[model samples]
Target: MPMDRRSVLKGASGIAAASTLSGCLGFLGGGGGGGNQGDAMLWHAMTESETETFEESLSIYNDENDAEIVAEENGDLRNNVETTLPTGDGPEMYRWAQDWAGNHYQRDFLYDASDDIDFNLEDTFSQAAVQAITVGADDAVVGLPVGGETVTLLYNKDMVDSPPETYAEMESTMEEYHDPSNGQYGLSHPIDAYFVSAWMHAFGGYYFQVNEDGEGVTGLDLDETKRGMEFVRDSIWPYVPADTNPGPQQAIFQNGSAPFAVNGPWSIATFEDNGINVGVTSFPTVDGNTPSPYTGTSMWYFTTRMADDEDRRESALDYAKWISQSEERQRAYADAHSDVPVLNSISAEDLGDQVAGFKGSYEGGIAMPNHPKMGSVWTPTEDAMNAVLQDDADIDSRFDEAAETVRSNWEE
Candidate 1:
């Protein structure tokens, strides 16, 4: 999949808030040491509610631990962090992207958590998330997975009324469910790069073409992506109706104007808040296999700016690992934020009934592009998909165009 933030950026609130809380709770600042024990100051970019949640967790930690962690919500804490690392003013604890984690490792921004962290990796979390955060080209420890949002099928219950049992049924029912005469579309997703890569993935086409040897190399799959694009462009978007597609999809779903919509979990809160009965499932089936949502990894990173003292650095890594690798923490995350906890202990078995229906979808999730060029692929790709969605281009040809855009923009 391409590197646009939207595909990976679904479920916006949870990760950002969790990072801020964890960063602040573990933060140590000033001399990077406390009085006697030395004080640890953490500056984090967390929503006010999230900041409060972290403070409560800290209250629990303080009751047991000796180190005092002082934290505050820094409105621009994420941006302020880089500035601090160079001047050594950054928080001792913070959460950042894997790419940022890699860069900071070269700069010596973070510490190693191998020995000091409490969580047992063999028992906690997915292998992919752990591997992505901890291993890099140099095998240097970089960051931890604070949380992630997987792309899943988001449909308006009002439109479908009853969820479709199979792909054919789903499509057949769309005609009945959709009401263009009422100015409602069957579904709506932005016609931009972030949204397009996923629409492609659901169709079984990938950005990186595999050589005959089976090693991942570079080639465009545009030639093979037509069926999926046509289904969306000619079948789905037209039913959504012109002008009724609305501005951003969140608005459409919130107002119940769009009978069908597909986005990510971050929008879960809005749906629940708006009192919309939402149905979430695996991305969708095509070509005999259920499609996967593009999974993006978010992690806790250490920076070069922290004190070179191995002991303090170890503590920082411990903090990151604790949050990233703990089932207890992930469960707490789900309870506070509506997330599918990503640990072995908190499996589909542990999610209970509310999440049981959607757990299968999480298993089908796919990792988004890790290439440095991924961030740049979104715009053109979205434009290409929009061509299909807008009825401005042929569906078969439009997806091929999107694939070309992905290839042109991909770094690999």
Candidate 2:
């Protein structure tokens, strides 16, 4: 029997906990055939709930069509794909974040779906979802986006009667609830680049900006970037715990010590499991400017394994089209996993409040740059954030150093 939404939802917490423990393990090997195989295989690292919903959708598709597609859940999908695809041993397709679209396309590892796929990409998916998988000149589509996610302000309903609407109000609430002696905090927020992207965007700064030539230009040394970092250091960091790791930050919120947390949809199931009445909303405005978090899509990327084989390519594309175009299948994924569906037909009202809240957040977010050079920006930015938030280093100097590091890394 196919798994239902309730069963998937019930197993979410255990799946999340297991994933945390197995995150570092790589693919164990012994999967089906690769490039020459007639059947289409998909490698993914989806959680238990997402896998169940996806398999149910696939089962329906397989029954109605001649194409036979299989999903292999790997703990280290990204690494495995990167290492195996070049040798022609990778699966026909893989499900991953759209940010890898640029890198994979550049490496000649992706199949351009725009050339052969019949679906109307722009009309079927949201604008941001389409943009996430578009790479190189003339906007070549390297993948089909299924769902999206972004960070939002999640508050405990018992502690906060209404979610804060502005940074000033959030700061005041943080001050009121902060008690270092009791190991309590007003808010739990990670200081990494991914989490801090919202703050940078609110201050008119960005880690990287695509230029007129479609190349990414580093923005680490921008005055606005420094201002955003300073704002966090001065106004927000005071009430937050010194440990900026996501695990500890989430633990604070999960245990009910922190009333507010800036997290993604992946965190909702765990929070709910912990018995917190969580409410999701867009981040509070900063000086009349809304914070735009980095929005990312979970997409199905076709690999070169199917590129030269006409039959395999057709079968893989058929599966992609079937999965992406079906509103019922997409809605099932949203219901089971709290994802913001990319399908235009699935309105926010169709899903529950949790998905609606994330939809609002995703709509207001900045599509994360998929440029390959973006890989060079994270480490240096994290170093800068750690310096400013943890060690009280000078923001300007730290960012200046970070900018130089990014430039050097790109050059290398």
Q: Highest TM-score: which candidate?
A: 2
* TM-score list, all predictions: 0.76, 0.90
True-structure lDDT of candidate 2: 0.77
* Candidate RMSDs in order: 5.9, 5.5
lDDT of 1 by residue, 1-412 (tens): 2242531342332232333222111122222221113344445555455555557766665456665656555554444665666665556666434534434454555665554545666456665466446644444555567655554556777666665545566667556656757655556554433344455556666554334453333323354456555555655555554532224445556667665565555556656677777876555555465655555555656555345556556555555555665676666656665455556666676765434444555555655544344444455555666665555776556656655665655444
Candidate 2 colliding pairs: none
lDDT, candidates in the order shown:
0.52, 0.77
* Candidate 2 segments whose C-alpha is farther than 4 A from its true place: 1-38
How well is each residue in 1-412 modelled by candidate 2, as lDDT tens digits?
1111112222322342444321100112233333444467788776555666778888899889856787787765666788889887888888877777778898889987778767687788887898887888778878787888777888999999888899999888888899978989989876677776888888888888889998788988999888888878887788778887666777788889998988777777778878899998888999998888888787889888877678777888888888877888878777776778888888888988888888888888988788788878887888899988778899999999999998998888
Candidate No. with top lDDT: 2
Against the true structure, candidate 1 reaches a TM-score of 0.76
Give the Å error, residue 54, model 1: 2.6
